[model samples]
Target: MSGEMIYPRGSGAYFEQLRALLPRGAAWICEAGTTLGKLLSGLAVELARIDARGIDLIEEADPRTAYELLPDWERVAGLPDTCTGAPETARERQAALHQKLTSTGGQTIAYFIDLAAKAGFLIEIDEHRPAVVGMACDAELYGEAWAFAWTVRVLPFNGTQQGELPVAVAEAGDPVGIPLRGWGALDLECLIGRARPAHTTVLFAYEVEPEPALWFDFTR
Candidate 1:
């Protein structure tokens, strides 16, 4: 087995790779209808990771509000691009968002994560560095809230050393079998809360499969 690849030791690096993988003009959704409070907290964590990674977030209008309240529109109610950060004096706006998300239907959470993904945030909880492993999954899932499309990609803790290896990704369905270049750990827990209940959301996981896999041998 030969080893000749590199990967950053932080979730940010993984997220960067993932952001490049997402569809252009689309974003990773992180909305939690009926759980705006939870959504806010999750956003804070994501933003923290984004900051730590030094990723440039594309600013756009908040779509969740308009999407939820509007008719015949499958848009997101995103926060204002010029909006202030949540940690500062944004409690009032936060409360308002919480209320709006309380009764969101299917696809609401999906839309949010989509926005984050498109804006260069993360879709799943990816962790390479253990320092911020806790930041992978959102806190709202602990409260028995229904989260969907949960996934994450990580170094294989016990991966194979051939031309490729298998790593666990935070995908909801049966684990996707992909190819890797080395032995590393993959965590599938990061993607547990991207969808709403009774709704089918789509997310991806990076694992090890066999034969003709273009995902093999990452450049780090």
Candidate 2:
């Protein structure tokens, strides 16, 4: 892949092309990056759903669009103030991660990939690994129902088949109604590269979103 075109998570146009493959009403949202060039496209509207409870941009976005809308960790809502102390334990981090995932800023990105399962997801990917799939169950639209369609960008993991990312699952043991409680089930664990003893692996998820129909760019 040339650095000329934007990569999956960072490139807006790259994402727009990927999303055109999905059905309307159903959408593809994610937690990734967008390009300045994306604004020139029809997706220029970065909506904020303001209400009495709080101000939220709970609209659907593909990988890139969602990335653009997520609040900077430094600017996070309900975040611990600098005067507050840092978490001293793993339990606290788990609590904080859950708190962050549900927060508008976090869920803005978190909610989209939630759908990757039904829509079919590519959990992780890079130069060396095959594409991984079937990590999440599926997601229904959470925000305004009438947001963008599935014209989103989602980069797949290193395997083409299902169950590539064993760690990214929503735990089954978690409480009901907790986001990621898949009937109290999490993805099963499977070794992806036991044969490749020389390599090491870590996993992460990214998202995709729509851009204008005509806008396109590649290069500095």
Candidate 3:
């Protein structure tokens, strides 16, 4: 008798949850540090199939080129100008400003970094000590659905040797939950769940690949 092919455990479950969370016809934005950024790359491949294209957040030489790399830039540029007024809450005001910035192109990296900081979606994470890293996904891509943002602290450890990076989600500006680990297919699912969207435009302070993965054959 031939043995059945064994794939990574929980990978199927992860994909199922991903499919449920991101249905057909839904749009999504993905950002990653670089080609070797870790779990984001794998997730982007599957997610992109359902129209959740990835954007490269890696810093480039030219600002205009970076601006041009954003997905749906033309549409964002076409949005009506945002109004200047007192919003009911701080979050509202932040959202308003974010809309204005994204709607108009030709933004510099400093602008994005500042915006990400105000929105609590930018931080230092790869340092030697435990530090928070903020991540976000835009709701504009999905036409006004809630945008997701989360702050996670990367635990101090040798990820290269262990083959995993331990992380803990932050709550009320404090770390919570048992530290989750790994950067596998299943690990990406957990990270996504923790960073569930909740705002208008997804405000991320980094860059991601603008192109879809053209080589991986997920199905085997």
TM-score of each: 0.18, 0.16, 0.17
Candidate 2 per-residue lDDT, tens place, 158-203, comes to 4355533232345768666655512111221111221112334323
Query: Order the candidates by lDDT, highest first — what do you get?
Result: 1, 3, 2
Residue lDDT tens for model 3, 1-220: 2333222443444444554564354244222333322354466445554342233444222223444333343235432222133446534544444565554432334443343344333332211212234423421233212222332332222323333333334346445553343322233233223233334122222221223448788898
At residue 65, candidate 1 shows an lDDT of: 32
| lDDT over C-alpha atoms for residue 76 of model 1 | 40
**What tens digits encode model 1's per-residue C-alpha lDDT throughout 1-220?**
2332222345334544444554554244423332532444444556557775443222212323332233222224343322222223344444435443563434444555554443233434422222233654643323222233333432222333334443334445544565333323222222233233445333445444433436566787
Q: Give me the runs in candidate 3 sitting further than 4 Å from their true place.
A: 1-98, 101-103, 121-220
- The per-prediction CA RMSD against the true structure, in angstroms, equals 30.6, 30.2, 31.1
Q: Name the top lDDT candidate.
A: 1
Of the candidates numbered 1 and 3, which has the greater TM-score value? 1
Off by over 4 Å in 2: 1-120, 127-199, 208-213, 216-220
Per-structure clash totals for the candidates: 43, 24, 12
